[model samples]
Target: MVKKILIVCIGNICRSPTAENLMRDALNHADIEVASAGLAALVDSPIEPTAQAVLEEQGHLPSAHKAVQLTSQTVNRADLILVMEKRHVTGVLGIAPEARGKVFLLGKWQEDREISDPYRQGKPAFVHAYALIEEAVHAWAQRLVG
Candidate 1:
């Protein structure tokens, strides 16, 4: 059973944090742990407001998620790693080559799509990203804990 999941993106303040929370809520299994990180994080910043608003719209209030940087330790701790894009795979593996088998695109089961970041683009971009993230997270939840 996968005990720990890590979501990764460019900045921890947007897509990844959103994915992390959504996955956690979707799974809602006590034994699982969900977290997120950025290859190049904003470091201690809060989640983007647009992203937060979209999450609330979906009935899941955003948590106090502070940006965390991706490190070898965090990568190693993850039983599974879900990244937002293809290039992110390179970044995670560069941190820990042994993670290759465990790292996967979050949208791998959703036709291998990429979840784009919608930082300052306002509500529409955030909603679009949230839809993709919600689908991917739900797909993963079914696979991981169903």
Candidate 2:
């Protein structure tokens, strides 16, 4: 029933997009589509280079992602929306209060873990975030694909 999934973070260039691409690879479900958007998006931007590099190191060829902003319409379109942190949940609900039921933390299974932003940080930070995202994505994939 979850045909569309949206991942959200502060900026689409980092965590959310990483999770989006990783989920797309992990899910590989024909009926399901995974995408990412930012609470305050760097619209029309590509994935941050460091984040892209971390993904590449793990053999994931990052998609040609153009950052998008979270909107009520986008929120309504998704059967499920996953965010990086608690504030993101607030941000999404502010746009579409009716979506409270569908929005959840990306780390819902990992003790409700929160993924931190690595933008302007460094490769090490991006690497750390990627590991967390990858773990969470696999957990969701198992449930969704099962």
Compared with the true structure, what per-residue lDDT tens digits does model 1 show for residues 41-78? 99999998888888888899777999999999999999
Superposition TM-score, candidate 2 onto the true structure: 0.98
Residue-level lDDT of model 2, residues 20-129, one tens digit each, is 99999998755799988999999999999989888999999888999999999999999999999998999999999999899999999999999999999888999999
Candidate 1 clashing pairs, residues 3+ apart or interchain: none
- For each candidate, C-alpha RMSD in Å? 0.8, 0.7
Weakest 10 consecutive residues, lDDT, candidate 1?
Answer: 22-31
lDDT of 1: 0.92
Off by over 4 Å in 1: none
Residue 76 miss distance in model 2 (angstroms):
0.2
